[model samples]
Target: MTSELSWLRRRADKRAEIGPWELREGLRSRSSELRALLEERKLEHPQGTPEGNRVHRFADEALSELENAERALTHAHQRYKVGSHVAVGQIHIDTAHNLLLRLSRPSEIVSMMPGILAIVQSRLSSDDPRRARVEAIAQSPESIGEPERETILDAVGVARQASIRENLRVRSFVNIVGWVAGCLAVAAVLVALMGAVFEDMVPLCFTPYRGLEVGGYVVVCPVAMNPDPKGGRDINESEASATTPADYLVIEIVGLVAAGIAAATTLRRIRGAVTPYNVPVVLALLKLPTGALTAVLGLLLMRGSFIPGLSALDSSAQIIAWATILGYSQQLFTRFVDTQAQSVLNAVSAPNAMPPPPSPPQGATSSAS
Candidate 1:
């Protein structure tokens, strides 16, 4: 008996180790085994005998356990879906990278200043319109003083804006994709809970006539079906009900509420007590929702697979943690992007980078030197 108990404990441990993928494969095996065992027992044993009843009970229990395992796997998949919400916010990083690259173009042009200046000076007498503009740029940059320097800086600013505008369509596409991904995750939670609504509304009846059978699996309607008096058909249009997975609504509700809480917390932390009116109003409105959506998606993707210490809130807490992490993360990311932009600007305006045409010394030069 002690040996048997030890074996059973080992089996339980193995069962605990089974992840979503493993459980899915095992479902097919376990289901086949249960079916075969029942068929063998039915063929060999008398139906009414105690031994036959015991065998049937064992098979039924095994089948029930397999169903439970499938349900647990489904729950894990759902959690991962929620966790991935946070990853959707990665669009910001992608756009930042693209802008940084565009900023490099101006930096590259500035790096070759000596050649450009020489070309402009040599061709200054020519009537070519391009050379004329280049002559104007090369000649009085320092001679005309601080105002001319400011013009150069303004041109750089204009170039950056143009680059951003050029990629507006691509950026917009990314935003739309991100929003759709977030909405799909939210919809998944709703679909999971919708099962409970069906269960509450539909009444079940035990009958020998199965409503639909295909591929050895049966799809049973939740509502009762009575045999037609004259035709004797089992199908009834009015009595049929949609089948829903049982007992998942509570978890779905808890996850959604947790997502909302995480969103509120993120807004409080990132935007502070009040959003700054100086920033774009559209951005201010989106910040809270985007943070919350990313957090919820992140939790779903990461925590759905396992409920660590406890079952339900493990996923919810995961979502909140992601939201908070991302809110703080924006602080670091904002600094990083700014630093990249500044470095590019500096590269475009390096020391003695471009020789100014001979002119009187000016004390009020721009600091970009």
Candidate 2:
């Protein structure tokens, strides 16, 4: 049993180590396939004619871009292995993605067939028997005139440019969200550290009006400190010294636990997105810190008697329970963020598929009618 467990642990560690390498390999394989396709297309359509020349040019350009992308991916993998700056890895990944997008141009390819058919129909007279040839070529593009080819290429180029812009927009949004989440997480950590170091300055102890059975009122705190019972009617905030830095840390920890649970529950809703920017991961990270902050703030609000009915907590357990509740309540605030993230993910059309073609020009449709 021990040997089996050890083997499983080692296997898990190996899997973790290979993650970046797997990504690099996957991209390399894709680049290889694209390169082969480009080479074949170049062979089929030589530079003897205008369309062939264009094909040759596209193949050369795409191959060059593919090489760049492979270089970027290699650099990224190396940096990832060396534990270099995360932003450097991100830049390399973004470059590779952009280069690959240019090379593949799936949207352009999808638009090409229809665009060619449109161009052919527009140029050839309706009575021309060559119209039948247009349909045949549309089914399987064997040949097209230079003029019609240029028009189709122009339209496809426009579609490719639009796809690139859309990709950039989605990438930008994901980056912004990731940066914001990271900042918030840092802020939460700082706040917790500050509270821990300067416990007296930032005490989280609360004294209820209700007195203890013995006589005086006892202060309740998240931390497990001996309660100091005041002889007076009720112990005020200033008089309480039982609260320690652990109080804030305890609440933060509880909130973090709750947030983790929330994040786990949300995994069902998270769909796998094709883009490099993992929005769901970013949102999950955001929730953790937000939950921590909320937990601390929620306790503070309760201590200040902000919430009328739930002003006073009876014991340390009660305080911690409330912290957990408040921590999970971060979902209430972050749900809107989740919704927006989903919308953004949905807006990102698949890079490997074509979007719907644009509507015909106003006058062109009427003219055809």
Candidate 3:
């Protein structure tokens, strides 16, 4: 206990150099309270009953978990850096967050009685003495004996497990999102590199019927120079010089810019929560490379005359405008992802309420009647 208190004091002294101010302050406050609780427990005489021993053991284990949580937070703060380190730090912080949440739950369990009672009411028949006892205890918590307390603790344990599972699911989803974003980013870079290296081989140029007349044929490329309009050569021959790596690069940049705007619009959907995971940031990143890829593909589709009535683009400004539109159009695909992410966030942010009871079978209700 003394060592733990000393560690807390030391961390408090270095508060400015640690994690976020809010987290640091919250941990400091909680640690002080936990230390006092442990001290009080230490002062209690050893009990002979199995339940008393079990409760004491649980308290000891809780203290150990709290210490581990503190260490995780400290490690996360110390290892904080950019790139992959950011992910590692976030994982550590999340671990600490979960542990702290579980450790602090017992105190909040009293307030959770309504939900617990709901669970008990649903599972146990109305006339069951144990169910009645639970309800009575709920009405007057001071009347709880060891057996009643044990039953309440059992319910709380089940709820805690569910909460833990939900947190794990959220973490798994965030990790998957981060991986996908990374892959898309890599793919975008590769595409850009391919565009740069094989510029003429895979040109983004198009031959519009109404383009600048070259040898009586319309030739259009994204470059400033169009093959001499009066050279009297085929339109295909002029396309090579007009299209360069810069065309694809510029379109990609425009697409990225448009995607960024779209990403910003999603910020309004984010809810404030105490979680260490940054789902919004990951979701935003997922949009960026997707936008860039879509922009390039959209323009390519147009260049190939795939979209009737909008096949031919006459000017550089027109192509850029189209790129911007395509970039923003990434939302059409990412909207589903946004919806899913929102649902996940909502699940995590939901109050620690009990799940609704299952409805009775239609046949069973009719039979009872």
Question: Highest lDDT, which number?
Answer: 3
Higher-scoring candidate on TM-score, 1 or 2? 2
Off by over 4 Å in 1: 1-182, 197-246, 271-369
lDDT of 3 by residue, 1-369 (tens): 999999997776575244354555466566556656654554462557764565466556656655654554554445342123223333333333333333333445566577768655654445656666677779886555556667675554454444455556666777898899899889888888888887777777765654454334444655544634554665656777677878778888889999999999987877755554667888899999989999999988987779997777776778888899999999999989888887777666543334457798779977988
Q: Can you give the TM-score per candidate against the true fold?
A: 0.24, 0.68, 0.73
Check candidate 3 and list the clashing pairs: none
Q: Please list the residue runs of candidate 3 whose C-alpha ends up more than 4 Å from where it truly belongs after superposition.
A: 1-21, 46-59, 76-136, 211-215, 225-231, 351-369
Write down the RMSD of all candidates, one decimal each.
32.8, 10.0, 7.6
Would you list the rank order by lDDT, best first? 3, 2, 1
**lDDT accuracy of residue 366 in candidate 2:** 75
Q: State the lDDT of candidate 1 residue by residue for 1-369, as single tens digits.
A: 999999997876455433334333444454455446445544665558886666555545544544544444344324433212112212222232222222223434454345555533332334445445545766544353344434433443343343333234323433454564466556655655554566534322122323333122122322222333333333333224322354233333343454444434443433211110111222233333344344334334433434354222212234344445543343332333234323333332232235456774675465435
What are the lDDT scores of the predictions, listed in order?
0.39, 0.65, 0.66
Largest TM-score belongs to which candidate?
3
Sort the predicted structures by TM-score, highest score first: 3, 2, 1
| C-alpha root-mean-square deviation, candidate 2 | 10.0
Report the error of model 2 at residue 239, Å: 4.7
